[model samples]
Target: MADLETLKARKGAVRRSEIPSNVLTALNRGEIETVNLVEFLAVDHAKLFRSTRSQLSLDDKSAKLIAATIKKLADVGVMQRLADTGQVFHQVLDGSEDREAVYQQLAAHPSDVLRNWAAYMDAANAKLTFAQRLKRAKPFAIDDNMGVREIAWMCVRVPAADKIVSQIEKLHPFAKHKNYLMRRFAIELSRPCGVWTKHITALKERPEIAQPLLEFCREDETKYVQDSVANWLNDASKTRPDFVETLCDRWLSETNSKHTQRIAHRALRTLRKKADA
Candidate 1:
């Protein structure tokens, strides 16, 4: 969201007349592969102030073309300059093997390294393809808050039901994250398409993990989680009345939300139908 004036200020003192044509061409085609074009600038570091030894001894027209190209690339979000290093960085927005590999590398590293790497990657392009990114992201999920958030977002983008179920099972161990991350993870697993009976049963078996979600439902804090729980209960109640009745009774007795009450009523109805039949 940077204004033209702000972006121009960041570029600093580079006259429109000092840029190169090849650089301009690369920028126009959105093919500036290098991170910092400034590094490739014509200035000669060894020969101080020897303007004659620069890479491209350009005239006015060539320089203007280069400047315009840089401006256009920056405006279109193809590249960003790192404030700390003052290096121009290019990000791959489209699905590229190179970009996917970079995320995989980041995912394998430790948390601190991963954070810096993700920031660098994000600067290059904000969105990533889920399938390409998830293989690397899965391991990092249990290790860091940022990783958990990234994995959660990645899970939502997965189209395959089996993949989603596997991811949920893998991430279930990290259900102990602080509220912010925990809430997101919980909601992601609660999706209708993502649900698996085995996964829910596994979750229910672990009181420590299941307890927080039950608490959230009892408190009626997140409507998404509540709705998910209601759906899960209703589905389970048809085939597993004993399990459903146990959970419904436990939750209804402990919490007072209208949603929980409604869930309890549904469970009771299911039980009565079973008894009458």
Candidate 2:
């Protein structure tokens, strides 16, 4: 929600075109000290620069410079401040692979910062090979924060799905994770059609992969997880109406739990309407 003037000011400025860069530059140039940077980012996040770092399409040079600046701050004993501010961490991972190196330096830092950083780092754009990117992102997909875990799955899914042998089979184990978010993450990733992401070109025969996820989620208690499960089924109904109808009809007949029944029924709404017609 950056104001017009603020956005205009950012558009042409080579050093800090994005709000995150503006804040980072101000700290890097001594215009504002670390304390001021923290106040501007973490505590007083007013409406002026509400755009997250990912929204700002920063040029290569600026991203590298900001990565260096973040490293500088960490070296200067203000690493905790960088970890504390969502904006700071957002910029750190905003399409820049260099930020991964910075995170490596702060590997022993708090989980909050690591999880936040893990959420946005796009390994596909990294300088490393595909294997290396997977190596880098694999551990974070199970991060403590649900959002972080979701994001980590996103970073690896496309590339890994296309390249890895038996990728869906390998990922099935995540459904058994203790945290409901990780379980949800596994279900969503196995989706036949991408939600916002590119369609899984490799998963041509979709129903085989989708069935297990639906079964695993049928008994889930977390409302958030159930919602995702419902959405996943809804997405499937568009291409596999028969499969969805059959699954829902079976689940409805077998399960008496209101929550699971509600989700399954909702997912089958389109097919049900078609059947009525």
Best by lDDT: 2
Query: What's each prediction's TM-score?
Result: 0.33, 0.55
lDDT of 1 by residue, 1-277 (tens): 2432333234322543545554333333322221233422332211211221122233354334433433444333211211111111113223434444444443343222232334444333435343433433444344454333433333333333344444444444433345444544554454332332124443343323344444454445545445555655555555555666787788878777787886567536756777899
Worst 10 residues of 1 by lDDT: 81-90
Q: Give stretches of model 1 more than 4 Å off.
A: 1-181, 187-217, 262-277
Q: Against the correct fold, how does model 1 do in TM-score?
A: 0.33
lDDT of 2 by residue, 188-247 (tens): 776666554666644434665656666877878888778877877777787777777788
Q: Distance (Å) between predicted and true CA of 160, model 1? A: 11
Model 2 residue 195 CA deviation in Å: 3.0
Q: What TM-score does structure 2 among the candidates reach?
A: 0.55
Local distance difference test scores for all models: 0.41, 0.54
